[model samples]
Target chain A: MNVLYFAWVRERIGVPSESVETQAATVNDLVEELRAREDRYAAAFADTSALRVAVDQELTDFDAPLAGVKEVAFFPPMTGG
Target chain B: MRIIVQEAPFDFGQQAQAFASGRQNMGAIVTFTGVVRDDASGALTAMEIEHYPGMTEAALTAIANDACARWSLGDVLILHRYGRLTPGEMIMMVATAARHRRDAFEAAEFLMDYLKSRAPFWKREVTAEGASWVAAKDEDEAALDRW
Candidate 1:
């Protein structure tokens, strides 16, 4: 699966996108897996409440299933207009 | 319906003239434009807009489609720019057309409300003091409840 970040989340993670092979069943589970990978991931994923997630380009909750999901995006709340 | 997401600036007057023209059955057309606002201290340099490449277009299209479904709209146009923009520069615009003034006005407002929170774009205010993300507002979220 491909994982992406935007805005401050991208800045904190130091990368925009990456390919990750994971056995996680949900987005939060993926976050845990990323947190365990390194301290930067740990600090970035430390606060889940401040972040929003999208599964396969659709806005979804952290508990959303990752089955057959091709891409996952994490970012701060959108301030679009 | 037309959705345009680009980095270049757009001509609002020309676009509005073109959109409002050539309408036969549609009696009303409404347009809204968002401009980059400066900070209170006036130290702001620019506003940086960041958006998900593929998802931003899709999200705006979906929102416009929803508005079309709910209203008796003749057409809809949404244009959003991403990149660094100076204060007083136009950031985005939304135009809606319908048979009546109420429908045209309501659809434009609905588009604005959804785009404010639902679109996959984040804004950062750059100033001499530093830069910071424009936090999503509770009131903006609450504004959606009225629809």
Candidate 2:
């Protein structure tokens, strides 16, 4: 699966995109895996309220199922125009 | 519908006309432009905006779709610039077209509110003292909750 980040989320994570091999069954579970990677990941996911998640281009809850999902993206509340 | 993320400046009057032209069904067109400001009261030297490539577009696309679902809109345009920007320069634009004035107005408002609170872009201001990342505004998030 491909994981993506945006804005300061990308900066904190230090990479824009990465292919992840994970056994997590849900988006929340996947976040747990990422959080365990390093302090930066932990900081990014430190407060779920500051972030929003999308699955395969659709805005979804963090608890959304990841079954057969091809892409998952994490970003801050949009500051764009 | 068009969504542009660029550092180049844009012409609002031209873009609005293009969005409404040839669409007889569109009775109302509401547009909003966000410009760079000297937030620090002349203390800031420069402002630089940054965005994530793939994720930024995807996020904006989702936001545009959501606005479409909530309003009877004919068309919408979103333009946000990245890189260095100065006061008085246009930073972003959101335009909505609809059959009625209310829809166009509401959709345009919804798009701006969502963009301010949801889009994935950050600004770092270089001040006379030092450079610092601008924090997201709580009032912007509160504005979204009103709708």
Candidate 3:
């Protein structure tokens, strides 16, 4: 799976995107896997409530199933207009 | 319906004029433009906008389509820009055409409300002091409850 980050989350993670090999079945499980990788990942995933997730480029909750998902993005709430 | 997401600046006046042209059947046309604004200190140098590559267009199109279904709209146009932009520069614009003024105006407002929070775009304000991401406002989210 390809994990992507944006804005401050990108800055904190230190990279925009990365490919990960995981056995995670849900977005929260993936977050847990990433969080165990390093301090930066832990910090970024520390507060899931402060973050938003998208599975396969569609906005969804962290509990969303990741079984056929190709891309997952994590970012702060959008401030567009 | 037309949706445009680009890195380059757009000509709002020309686009608005073109969107309203040749619509003899439509009685009303409403257009709204969003501009980058400086902070209260007036030290803003630029606003950097970031968006998801493939999802931005899809999200905007879905919002426009929903507006069309809810309102009796004849046409809709949405143009949003990304990347670095200076203060006072146009950030985005939405134009709606309908047979009645109320439909056009309300549809435009609905588009703006959704665009403000639902879009995948993120904005950061740059100043001499530093750069900071613009946090989503609670009111912007609450504005969606009306529709």
lDDT of 1 by residue, B1-147 (tens): 999999999999999999999889999999999999875757889999999999999999999999999999999999999999998999999999999999999999999999999999999999888999999999999999999
**TM-score of chain A as modeled in candidate 2:** 0.95
- TM-scores for candidates 1 onward, in order: 0.98, 0.81, 0.98
Model 1 regions more than 4 Å off = none
TM-score of 3: 0.98
Fnat of candidate 1 is 0.90
lDDT of each: 0.95, 0.84, 0.95
Q: Over 4 Å off in model 2, which ranges?
A: B23-25, B58-62, B65-70
lDDT string, candidate 3, B73-127, tens digits? 9999999999999999999999999999999999999999999999999999999
Q: Which window of 10 residues has the lowest lDDT sum in candidate 3 chain B?
A: B36-45
TM-score of predicted structure 1: 0.98
Which tens-of-lDDT digit does each residue in B64-86 have in candidate 2?
Answer: 99989999999889989999887
Give me the displacement of residue B133 in model 3, in angstroms.
Answer: 0.6
